[model samples]
Target: MTLSREFKVGLFIGCTAIIVVLALLYLAAGKGVFENLHAFTVSSKSGDGFTEGMPVVFSGFNIGKVQALELNEKGIVLIKIKIPDRHVKWIRSDSAFILYRPLIGSARIVVNTTNLNSPPLDEKKIPEVIIVNDINDAIARIEPALERVTQIADNVERLTSNLSDPKGDLHRILSNAGKITTNLASKKSLVEMVVSDEESVKALNDSLKKLKDITTNVDRILTKVDKMADKTDSEIYGKDGALPQVNVILKDIVGKLQKLDKTIDNINKISSDTSEGTKDLHILRSDIDDTLKTVEDAVKKLDAIIGLKKAPEFKVP
Candidate 1:
């Protein structure tokens, strides 16, 4: 049953040809060769980004393909597009086609229809190919955002620069903190760290020592004052203290005051009696003065009556 070498070679060639035909069929089927297609033309200014059999997309779905590319006598390039009859309803008279050459992926021909119910597209009225460069759009979209990011980065860099500057507040504070920590770790006192001079430290220590001595002396004086106060309290308030003697002296003085009050009452009574005697003497003196005046008037009248008759004889005798 072994075949000849020539027959085997021909069999191999036929098998290879069958495989090639299947591949062609597979590729053509993918391009809608087996299905009915609706044809339309798209005129473009340039056909630089077009390819044959490229999928025509409608709303993210592949509905047709670019059938052929040609140039007319007026130097305008015409792209023939074939849409499946089933998808032809999506193409309206006012449908737009965009040749989107993206920055990241392969170029595509995109279809955008405003209304699915609109009149069917006419074959005579060719759709214009709108070229869109993704790179340019990307640059346009990214320019403002990139500028804002750059502004924010510049602010951050300035902040960092200020923070790191030797003359800045943050750096000065850190330097001070470092010196304080180092001084403390090296067993230098807080005053020593602040004053820097040993003589100042010695003077401060001397002053503190003098203050301590003055505090001790004040404490001793306060103790003595407290002892004196206790002694004074006992002397003034104890049972055998001067307070009881003072109370006895005060009682004796109160008794003397009562005797003096009685004596004062007796003296007031004697003054009243003496005032009564003086009033009687004043009345007796007034009566004696009246009697003397009457006697003198009678004598003056007797002398006037005797002087008429007796004076002539009495003068001779």
Candidate 2:
């Protein structure tokens, strides 16, 4: 037990080193150093009750912790969380992070995983923080619902009272219905008469007889028209009918028209040549005068041969 001063100093140094290592191991164990962890960033508009080291809970189990909180230049509050690998698979791409503040409790960060089979959210993806309804907000939402419930209750109460009262509007309405039923029962014969009156039956019978006569006339007329159509078809389009004769006449007319067309074409060509040759008006007038004198001499000789006393002068127009 009698140790030297140097030995005592060495012992003290050894104990200090051992204590430091144990503390480091304990810290690492508490922070899950041996377990696989995924880090994700969550952004919020307001960081009212959020802080570093807040627990991220899923189904009442704490699976992660907020590692850091930072406010960037854009004034957004960013919360960085580290979730253990075992629970990280539960955080889906469509998972929502809700910060719920109860009426009489501290704010809790809740992770809601809607789709279990969805792809896991990437560790580097930053999700938007969704703030849940606080006590005041929930109360504000329920006010309209409460008012609707009150209106429904009031209506139920009025209906109950109206049903119980014998002299109420509902009672009057039922009484009128009963009266209508009684009146209808008493006038059953009159209603039947109105539905089937004697004069209406007579008129209906007469109309049926007239419709039968009209149908007969229409049948006769249709038969006559059918005969007439058959006769006309036989006369017009039957074999050895007028249509063949008309076709032959039409062919003959067409042949004459072709000959007339050729004659017109020849006449047009002759007129064109004559116009081109007689470009001088004086020569054309002299030729016309000589042809007219020859025609006059022929006419005079024909009149003497026919023993005509005098022949009238023929003028060419």
Candidate 3:
């Protein structure tokens, strides 16, 4: 059957419309267009040149976009972000937001929310600025420190080069080591000469053996002396000794004293007999005196009788 031009035109138009609708649906899904969105506000000193439609990434995946940016009367940048409601729970009170520009990449807004138990962020809340405050100021501050590090490295390199030079003190130390080695090699014969004196070595060994023998003899003498001292002490201090002989001599002296006392008694009796002989001599002297007196009296009596007869005896012869 032959198709009419009007009919063909209408069929083509219908198919084209269906294809366009499907493409729009796919793009909207990729942009999270069908999902419910929540608005959160962040305030910062500066925007760091971030514009509307800039992606806001959570843990490296895009979760939202910056929908608007404005400045308040205080000149602070107010950023309004639209985040899908499905990911809104990830935005907590403790979450950190930063705008970072690395040395190699365009600036980006990063969200970090490792703590899930924190309180949820409120709607239209002004979030804190977490990164990239002043890039130019930081670079300016680090220039002097980097220059100092570079200067220190250059000084160290110069010192090392000076130490390695052949005419320097390190080279003189190495040359002295080589000279010492050469001197030791040339004096090998002197070491041999010192080791060759066998006679002196033998004398030293003999002296040591003699000293050992002397020590052994001294030990034996000490042992003998200790034994002799013990025996001498026992003999002098034992029961029968000179002390008992002295006691016997003292007893004999007492017996001689008794005999001397009897001799003194005999001498006293002889003295008494001599006194009796002297008394007898005095009695003989008295007897002689009495006999002489009697003779004198007889003479006187004869004289008186002769006078009375005197005239008759003269005539006869």
Candidate 4:
């Protein structure tokens, strides 16, 4: 059972072909050809710098590649990027895809994902965004910053010159600060330093002492005056003082006046009764004199009618 030489040659060639096929498949697998590929679309307003086969880079690593570009009726360029299934997690909902084409470098789609833990991007959503850079606009924005930087540099130069000058305000401030620090560290107190010597401080303390003594004397005098006022108030208002004695004297005078008024009324009544009794005695005395005269006349008539001689010589009264 020996094989032919042609058959052996054919067997060798067939085995070689099978090995080559297997190696090719292995190489393709290594390059992710057999791996699952996911697709997603992004839109751009202008497709000026966008091109197919552009590498999508994230954190300096290529995660995907741009597959196709199509311009729709709305003048938007729709870009489709293909990524291996394992790298799909890098495209988050919060991820940004920027079409950054530097003036001096090749154009690329730069993907930046701030939060890698966010939800995965929904591939079915349409009209995903891609930001493109404009060189003219960037330059326009940078011109003001350049001007501000120049102004800041000039201001720094001026500040440095001022700080370096000996006659400048900064130097004066630093010199004053040094002098103040030195004064503070010295044996002299701040008050002595500000007032220009210990002598002035001693004089101030002496004056303050004298003022304190004067205030104490005044307070003592005021206390004595207050005691005098209290004594005077007690003497005037006390129960046995001059005010109560004077009230007692006034009451005694009032009682004596009432007794004197009663004595005056009794004297007036006695004088009226004496006056009426004297008038009645005068009238009675006058009537007695008239009766004596009539008796004498009747005795002379009886002597004449009896013709009898009356004895003349004997005077019997």
For this target, which candidate reaches the highest lDDT against the unseen true structure? 1
Q: In candidate 1, which residue ranges exceed 4 Å CA deviation? A: 1-3, 33-54, 66-89, 96-107, 112-117, 126-145, 152-190, 210-317
Tens digits of per-residue lDDT, candidate 2, 174-271, equal 99889767766765355434444656666866999999999999898888777776766776567765556556655755665566566557556657
Name model 4 segments beyond 4 Å from true.
Answer: 1-3, 103-105, 126-317
TM of each candidate vs. truth: 0.43, 0.35, 0.42, 0.39
Q: What is the C-alpha RMSD of each candidate to the true structure, in Å?
A: 29.4, 20.1, 37.7, 32.1
Model 4 agreement with the true structure over 144-255: per-residue lDDT tens digits: 9999999999999999999999999999999999998888788378788687688889999999999999999889888877776676556655765445655655575566
Whole-model lDDT values for every prediction: 0.81, 0.78, 0.72, 0.77
Question: Per-residue lDDT tens digits of candidate 1, residues 103-149?
Answer: 99878899999888889999778879999989878999999999999
Instruction: Return the TM-score for candidate 4, rounded to 2 decimals.
Output: 0.39
Task: List runs of model 2 lying over 4 Å from the truth.
Answer: 1-5, 33-37, 68-78, 84-86, 135-317
Those runs of model 3 whose alpha carbons end farther than 4 Å from true positions after fitting are 133-317
Cα TM-score of candidate 2: 0.35
- Give the range where candidate 4 is weakest over 10 consecutive residues by summed lDDT: 308-317
Candidate 2 lDDT score at position 277 = 71
The number of the candidate with the highest TM-score is 1
